[model samples]
Target: MSLVLLLFVLSKGFKGSRVRDVRVRGFGTGGVDTWQTTPSVGWSRIVPKFHAAIVKFDIAYPYGKKHEEYTKLSAAGRGSPELLVAEVGVKDYGDMENMDLAERFGVTKEDFPKVKFFVNGKDKPFDFDGEFNAEELKKFIRRHSEVYIGLEGCLETFDRIVDRFMTTENQSDKKGLLRKAEDEWDKLKSPSDQQIAETYVKIMRKVLEKGGEFISLEKTRVEGLMIGRITKEKKEEMQGRLNVLKSFTHDEL
Candidate 1:
């Protein structure tokens, strides 16, 4: 499907509310059932099913930029069965049924857009303390969970190679993985795919030549160029390179 049409379908797919006795579905696989109300009982019953769940605690009728960014994140994460993106809406007045539940999680009305990530094997959810950009949210998910959510300009197959390439102490293993990445790059058909694949191969080559430290040094150099006086096209190019570099360094969020 075209990118625009796919986004439209993902936006529409994220529907349903009220956590009470609801059957929560995977975000990427099919329609996701989110919660409009924050009930402790509901969270206890449903959150355990998924490997990773990102829950947003906000006002009942949320709007404005932050909410829009969250919508983008929901759409971006719509293809991953390993992740669940949801919202828990709390009423500020009237019965205030969800207030206590929100308080239990340390979320307050003052912070209307608090986010928490719950992984299946963890006792407490990790708080999302970063900005609400869709790509940043994806990185946050990847950092905390085993789920693979590719950042823009990153190829998953090459990213897996990068993981092994960074971890293994054996130089021979690293060289073999770099060769494998080049072979994969050659097999890609489209120009855009080849362009992105080339970044992966180039980075692998640089890391092999300069050692593991090249990832950080090159990332710093790209980041510097991004902030300098550069054309829009150049800035975008740097951003793509930065994204690919991030795949090599998991410590970066």
Candidate 2:
């Protein structure tokens, strides 16, 4: 979808001009790579040579006001049929703040409004704990490629049981699909979508008990999530860890 990235996503944000970071980096065999403010290497070697990259590391100043609002949210966070949402300011790596590229990407300085999801040839990179807008970072890169709406009424059985529980590699094929997703969330029947499909099978059974630190626990807000409603001191501050996951906002969006 190039026509200058479909006119930069129908021009919802940009005050363009001057130098480096109007951005572009899409390589499926060297295709659209541009935007570089002195990076002859080092984003852990240019993010595994891109096939996915969501970096939004800021420190502002290049176009002010948090660098033109994260460069118009990385040009409306591109069209993502794979990924590439870059917008790295950090004062273009000068004024003594690169700190050896933030200690070779372990990130501190309070995780400077972080967002790093790179996945090209993988070298361990994933921590976009959602919500810092840009439409939840384009619904977390389209939930790494669509499928997330289940209450019954199969949608390719929860996206083929989350791509066979993130590409199985044994462990009894990941506990036999975590007991076939708790037997399809016990054949739901809308008791609040069977408690939201048992909180999406308890966050994919804690990502199969944390064996592969995540690629898809998949909750890109399928069908606009809901959590009844809160505020009784946020439901008595979540009535004793009501199974710990919470993010509810419904004012008619």
Candidate 3:
């Protein structure tokens, strides 16, 4: 595939990073099980931009096994603004009426359309494609979307890199590869980020030693479908928020 090089501009003399608020929904039959959301409190620190927070509703147990852990994390400021609302579903009209939620969290029914509920609250309209609102919604969705990874694939890839370094005798090359390996290990749970930085560098150096010119990247689909689908304007507005750096690389023939 063809390669696309992206030109990015960095703000001059900018010392403070933009603090980002992340709203993660683990919706299914049950809102993100409390046990699962607990670990994300620590993981959230890895991305300093995102201040840890949760907006949840329960379809299962009122409280999960790790409920106390999440509560503690929130109390310590590690997980801020963790809203645990139970029996959450798509309450279009009800959500809109609840001025308390709309004004406080800004999480209206329009923001989440997949799930619906019959609740005792004001309902909100789902106006995603209103001409003016369309543009704004597009921008919000792109920045707020989540990134997922396959843990097994990541570990196997890291092990392969470590094995390659163990067999190499050149001191300089060995040092470079091992450093790359450690970086990969740190972000193994995040394949896309690790791919652009650590994985690409390691593979390129290895191929150069073997007199090869082309490199390869394996792309995986969730539910057998491609995930990234932000609108053009949304893409331009969201730069560092969603790092699509790998999209610029050349695909192997």
Instruction: State which candidate has the highest TM-score.
Output: 1
> What ranking emerges by lDDT with the best candidate at the front?
1, 2, 3
Q: Each candidate's lDDT (Cα)?
A: 0.75, 0.47, 0.31
Steric clash pairs (candidate 2): none
Candidate 2 deviant stretches above 4 angstroms: 1-38, 49-51, 60-89, 92-135, 138-140, 143-182, 187-194, 198-253
Q: Could you arrange the candidates by TM-score from highest to lowest?
A: 1, 2, 3
What lDDT tens digits, residue by residue, belong to model 1 across residues 108-194? Answer: 999889988999846499999888888888889989888878888788898898999999989999999999999999999989889
- Among all candidates shown, the one with the greatest lDDT: 1
Write the residue-wise lDDT of candidate 2 on 1-253 in tens digits. Answer: 6423533343323324332332333322223334333233334344444466666655543334543444454555343334555545454344544444544567665677566766664756677775565545544554553412211212335446655666666777767776886788789676755555565466566766774443222223321223546556544433322212221111101
TM-score attained by model 2: 0.28
Candidate 3 deviant stretches above 4 angstroms: 1-51, 54-90, 93-99, 113-152, 156-175, 179-253
lDDT accuracy of residue 52 in candidate 1: 86
